[model samples]
Target: MNRNALIAAMIMALLGGFLLFAYLKKFEEEASGGAPVKLLVARKHIEPGTVVTDDMLATRVVPAAYVETRAVREAEKARVVGLRLATPVQAQQTLLWTDLAITADDKRDLSSLVQPGMRAVGVRAANDDKSFALMRPGDRVDVIATFPIEGSTQRQSIVLLQNVMVLAVGLDTTAIDTSKQGGSPSSQDLLLNLSLTLPEAQLLSLAAEKGRISVALRNPDDVRITDSLADLNSNLLTDSKTRKTVQDFRKTPTGPVKLPSAAGAQ
Candidate 1:
């Protein structure tokens, strides 16, 4: 055979062999389940600003065709910044979705009143008492007030309120460090400005006029609802039943029951 023809035949043979090998490889891949099965990126709990790492991918026990490349790619770009994650991901509780807005004023306000999920009560602080230094905004306390009648020695120290929120201390709306005092802007000496309801405020004012007020710390678990003196007093004085009883008592004859004189009886 001619040299050129032999060379051409050899090239053609090599080409044919290459094509056969490619075909066989393709057939083997088809018969043996194609490429390796991979994980699907779950859509739930995908937080904003969260970096998608290999660990974030969700794998399945059985190889399935439902896993899409697009889903995986999308998950790779997911991030979390502020919002809460609905579900916890593997080894990760989804990142925040948005920025949390927490400011000094917010913290101060929250420290005072009933918080988002908390219940609050009101109590009175004494103007002349020195024990206010012992109380704070978050401190739990039982309020006691004593009222003395005019021109009389009788005095009653009753529990005016309980489980009340200490909103502020000595006009400091925010939290204060009571431990240290006497510095620049000299801190007020533990004068607490408590948050009280309208009725509690009235009671505080009334008690301040007649007697002294004091506070007692309570157990963390001891939350009691005390009677509102204003409401009780108003009801006792104005209620129809109470009014009728008072009226009947007043209408009863004041005439003294006559006992037989000793001489008459003999």
Candidate 2:
């Protein structure tokens, strides 16, 4: 045949072969029923412990081969509708069953925030005691317990918990909202939530019930655990010279007044 005719035939043969391959592939996919599956994905950045709502979720159709093993199926929408996210999910990311905290109540509960073997215990404090409302979530603090000394009538203070994380300060856990200056939380409703082991939770509860509890904010990097239980008496003064000088001044009266003798006689 002619050179032009031969090239035209080859092009026509290639086009026919491409069409046949496409038709066969379509038939195979239909026979196997391998269509794209819909996966539930986060429409926005969902933070951990957030309740899953309709507005925050969307669906994406992924090929059967590309579908993730643990991706939440669109058919299971009801199961995850009210559940909480155990970890943060980025926008347009496929939601996984493992990422959610499934509970019968289908609510975002505070217990979910507690560690596996730990408990979340809340302790009430006077507003003036806990940084005057400056404390917020994730702040580390040392829980101080003040109660009457066993034998003496004076009150002594001791650190009950050191380098403990403050889960929630007051009812709000995210931040201290001061938008409405006149609607600040009352001192009576102030609370400090803590994550502690079972034994530690019990000890903290007992201390709160029996004595006064206060929190001393600490530097985040200060993880030093000291066994030193210093008493809150005058003797606790670091400088002995200053303590002695104050003692000598208190003993002598500035004005001329009749002083009682150290002996029984007045």
Candidate 3:
């Protein structure tokens, strides 16, 4: 072969080798799961309607191919931290955009929803009461105050306000919950915002500070107000066994025992 032709053949062989090497490397990357991406996941099981915070979140790098299209990424972590989840996410599970509560996208002022004669206030829903976190916007609730009555040995449980509208639950404004998210309750308080009159707000403030407040969920269609409602006290305990237990406890008052939540923590 001619000298020029021999050099040309050598050059072509080197070029082909380079291209083949590059192709193999690319194929291997794809087979292994492609490039790593920073995906945001729940550090612990997160309950529905619970507001997310930085401590509850974690970032992991996984193969790009394994990630869900709707999964929240590290860049979006800031936005998700302060928002509520519409559904529950398991520990180490990927957080998706679809997991966000309806209120997560709400940027409007809550003041706009408050009428001139009404006020909006937030109440902390007990972690034990899953119903309060499940309440939705526009749902009716009856606020009940349980506190020690003046000059009485027993506490009085009376209805403070009836047929009050639930403005928001955990700031979600959705009464719905995801069955999948059921698990140990989040450490974060399930915040509930209610719409109330000025007088009712004052009453709630006073009652909430004085004693524990509980909300009774009401049927939206049933707006009939009950009159002459009697307050509940120790006298109402008709069950002999239960009454004995209460009386025994009251005599040497030890608060209720703390136990693990119904939904066991993972």
lDDT of 1 by residue, 3-81 (tens): 9999999999999999999999888766765644443433345543354454444543212222221122223233322
Q: Write the per-residue lDDT of candidate 2 for residues 197-249, one digit (tens) a residue.
A: 89999888888777788888877556666665444653437668766764564
- Candidate 3 weakest lDDT stretch, 10 residues: 249-258
lDDT of each: 0.49, 0.71, 0.73
Q: TM-score for model 1? A: 0.37
Candidate 3, which segments miss by more than 4 Å at Cα?
A: 1-103, 174-189, 238-266
In the range 154-210, model 3's lDDT, one tens digit per residue, is 888898988777765554544345325777545332667788888888999999898
The true-structure Cα RMSD of candidate 3 reads 21.8
TM-score of each: 0.37, 0.46, 0.47
